[model samples]
Target: MRSLKKSLVHMLSVPLLLSLSCHSFADLTIDGKPAPHQNLSTHDVKELLADDDELELTPQGSTTASTTLRQSNGAPPAMHSGVVDTTFMNNAGPNVHAGSALVMDAQTGEVLFSKNSNSSRPMASITKLMTAVVTADAHLDMSQDITLEPIDFDGPKKASTKLRAGDKMNRAEVLLVALMKSENPAAAALARTYPGGKPAFIAAMNAKARELGMSSTHYFESTGLDPRNVSSARDLAILVTQAYKYGVIRQFSSTPHYDFNLGYRMLNASNTNALVRNGGWNINLSKTGFINEAGRCVVMHTTVNSRPAVVVLMGEPTTQARNTDATDLLNWLTGLPKDT
Candidate 1:
């Protein structure tokens, strides 16, 4: 009976000893050196732990201090991983007055300079570029004449056009008017006459945007009068590049002037983009837009420094400001005089 009692006592003492051992270890210095209980205060423990690199615990549960700190704090304020951040170099080049702008290499899709390139804003008449693309891609009968109707005039904003309610023009001619002169009614007519009508035409525009990797672009109407027709400078650059692929779009957009006759009367229209009409630069594709919400907007595929490039300028305060912004960009790229 005494032997059985002694065995139980030994087992209980064993657990007590193990607990004491753990408590002793917890009271020691973080470097594994023996420390008195009085020296194991919270401050002392923190200091010891900080000095002992191997015992340091990181947010990621790793012992590497440098990497852990960097990961915890994130990248520096000025560093941009993927998109171009022009904050540092805003003054390095010409002073651009546009609210947002982008210059990209058309051949390689490389961003040359960007300021808020991903910010979406109303695109104004530049929306016609997508309208032209969708119309051309549909392979509609270009010679089929479409009569101007009151429905085409349906929009919140009234657009100026010489075509009367009963005036008639073929699809190709209307497309030219839309691209060259930015005629809102002509663009709406193109969409209205599409196989699935305006809804399908708008759907095709968005579908084309997706196909071209314009993730930040959206279109609500063929004419850009709706402030809802919005896109970013980056997306517009992609658009200008894609639109340049179509020979007809390039031809029509770059045309200096065009005349249309309604048999009883003649309506003459000129390209809204003065750069195309001025013949001062080699502009392969050009489109301009304006609305109260959109400001002055322009997108072009032109030669910069003898290399193909796409330039997008949006939210300029005035028509001259938009033109000046484009000229300044071209001059900077091509090494022209700063005063030019």
Candidate 2:
């Protein structure tokens, strides 16, 4: 009985001692071997505060900047090393800028994030995305030969590509250049041959916009070159999502460069989406747009820090500013919660 009692006591004592050992180690890591139940040294508190670089941004130079986020006495003021917060977006960029921007959840269309997204403004060639979707949906014979009519190039609007009355090409090939290359004449041709003409084609574009649940969108032209064609950033995000449904639309929008033939000449088409051709991004879908009235713009579907990300910038004063906005947004996103 004595021997059995000794074994039982040892078993109980082993776990109890192990538990105490773990508790002690967790309660205090030995640095300068402080005694138990005592306050941590000032040096220890400083070490805790100096944990890994939390913001993950180290600015280029030693010059430091901090905004007064709060003024509660003895409290740590909020600070960030880079990028604009979601709460103060409109004020971050150019003072002359006006227009909404959005970054949405692609699958559910649930608005994960928004910035003045409902304010309508000219969309520029971003309209070509919708035009491409509608043309692909029309199910017209892709192989059908479209003989370029003199009227195709004769509209009051200035022409971007020279196409004469006699030039001919297959419909699908032209739509490819229209969408991928943003060849204005090709888009005009596709719209012209639809049952009616420019007027009817535009009506269909508006109807399609309504179908996509775009409330503030209006289309005065098929290609977005016409400054009168306007849509809110909220509406454009939906337009972009619908445009992604067509496989060719996604493939062509991501294309950085291609060779295209206009009856008389073969020209190289380069994507305006700087980020795709840009070495830094993993861009799956993208498009850049502009007109003097619209300012510079870009909408891209991509991934940052292993999470789905949509970065859109508009109304930048300079072309460089648009690029800077995207870069800043991406850097902010990579540090946000749920990024991994």
Candidate 3:
């Protein structure tokens, strides 16, 4: 099998992903105690593919689905809940390729558009965002140097990474590469060096999720290589919103590119989300993830129509599809009046 790095290179040349396979969900245990409500079965890719008929465009508080959106004087409601506002719905919205997608007002937590948004799916390296948050909240010394060990290369997928076993970087630099480049080894190293190690870091991730009201979210490790690390679009919207509050997260996640000095050589890393590199976007926070089981996924906090918005797109078949969906959503939102 080709390494993940090679596969990603090939993926960039191809227009679509031809096949996908499921990985058995890893068991969850924290400090030798089983974590509650963890699923152990393989979450098949076919299951993540929702039928077009099953698609529904609904708002946060709306009890009934409606295709008709009531526009008051050509402006959408600036903030609304429990009422239908098909601002990004069926024919009115973009042709989103993701199996599950959501757009929410960052400040109000109002879900403006949703498609299977509540369904849980593998989140891939988007897990690093949570890892970054947990690490930040711990208030660890950012200047402390961390050495990546051989075990950092060990993960469920065994994906190839640019970071070497002996690579030395400060805590802040490690977190930066993890979020910006979706570097699995960097993420693993962060958890491995955490207060009580990886297990404790996993616990903190889950605890933070609960505190932020992400009931549908769970974590098994820091790298997101574990298929069991799953979350819904709705749950991740809350995460994106909360993660944007952190200054370092906002800066590192959205940074277009950076050159990391490994003492022996330099490693050039770019943000996983393409939109962040584009001059057109005003992104505040961004994360992207992919594995065979999770497919292509992305979450972003950006400004749209002068209003802060959070977007979560998951289970996309290809990188092009994910980028297109994001572009379409952003453009759709931009067309809306600022008052909306």
Candidate 4:
């Protein structure tokens, strides 16, 4: 009788233990703590999981879990949020071949595009722009004949020029050649003839840059052959915009070709900027620059999508690359909304 009673008690305890084990499975956590196990409707499930993490529902009616899981795991967010819009954010803008570049609205000074724009670099013949500006500000006798001297041919590059030692040309003609053709001797002669000579002319250039808020620009010499003649793309854009206000610079820099009687021969000088010579671009102001230190460079004031804009490109590997970069930027700007 005792054994049967013991056996019956053991059988009862076994079924009770099995029942507890089956019902005691782990509960899911909603907010870092265990939630009560219960039958949850779709709405209830959403409400429970909503505060815990961000969830995406699939077309199959299943919750896809947190999209921010990567963030929690120390991953950076995507470069662009949501669907990418090519109009506002162009992936190709950063791919421009120039080491430094900037595009700004000529009238409003609004920056539209930039890459290393503030980093100062050698500006090569773009120095002529400032040379032109300082010469213009002098208000000298543009018609007065100025003779080129040995000091004017002091650059290390030994570039060929139509003007020879003792070759006399009117100040206006000199200015035209200096700007349009990047004539080194003409620029040096302009600085040489300044009131206090080259030193005073360089000081005036710095002063003019300060006046125009080009803090990153500095000029060691009038001719950009000196590698120390440096400025940032941002600063060059400012210089170009200010220079565009001068009608002489606009006309001279944009002239495709100019014929001048040097008495010995009829010398013809063409604009250094190919875009200006191409006739397809409505270039208001243009300048091209190059040296071993500063690669192919260009600055221009042109209308893009009917908006006047200043573009500065520096340290491009090739002239063709620089032109293509400018064209790509122009097309990108044209595609953008007018408000941009």
The residue-level lDDT of candidate 2 at 269 comes to: 58
Instruction: Indicate whether candidate 1 or candidate 3 has the larger lDDT.
Output: 3
Cα lDDT for residue 102, candidate 2? 61
- Against the true structure, what is each candidate's TM-score? 0.73, 0.66, 0.74, 0.72
lDDT of 3 by residue, 174-277 (tens): 88889988999999999999999999999999999888767778999999999999988777877876676554576667766666767788787767788977
Candidate 1's residue-wise lDDT over 1-340, tens digit each?
A: 3342222122211111111111121221112232233212233223322332222222111111121001112322222223544532222566778877887656544555677776778899999999988887776666567898998888979878777788787666688788988988899999999999999999999999988767668899999999999888877877876666554566667766655667777676678988877878877679999999999999987765446667889899999999988988887777632222
**Residue-by-residue lDDT tens digits, candidate 2, 222-277:** 77778888776666766665554344455556655554455467555566766655
Which structure is stronger by TM-score: 1 or 2?
1
The alpha-carbon lDDT assigned to residue 118 of candidate 3 equals 62
Off by over 4 Å in 4: 1-94
Candidate lDDT scores, in order, read: 0.67, 0.55, 0.69, 0.68
Model 2's TM-score against the true structure: 0.66
Instruction: Judging by lDDT against the true structure, name the best candidate.
Output: 3
Of 1 and 4, the candidate ahead on lDDT is: 4
| Native RMSD of candidate 4 (Å) | 33.0
Model 1: lDDT of residue 166: 80
Residue 99 in candidate 3, Cα distance off native in Å: 0.9
**Of the pair 2 and 3, which is ahead by lDDT?**
3
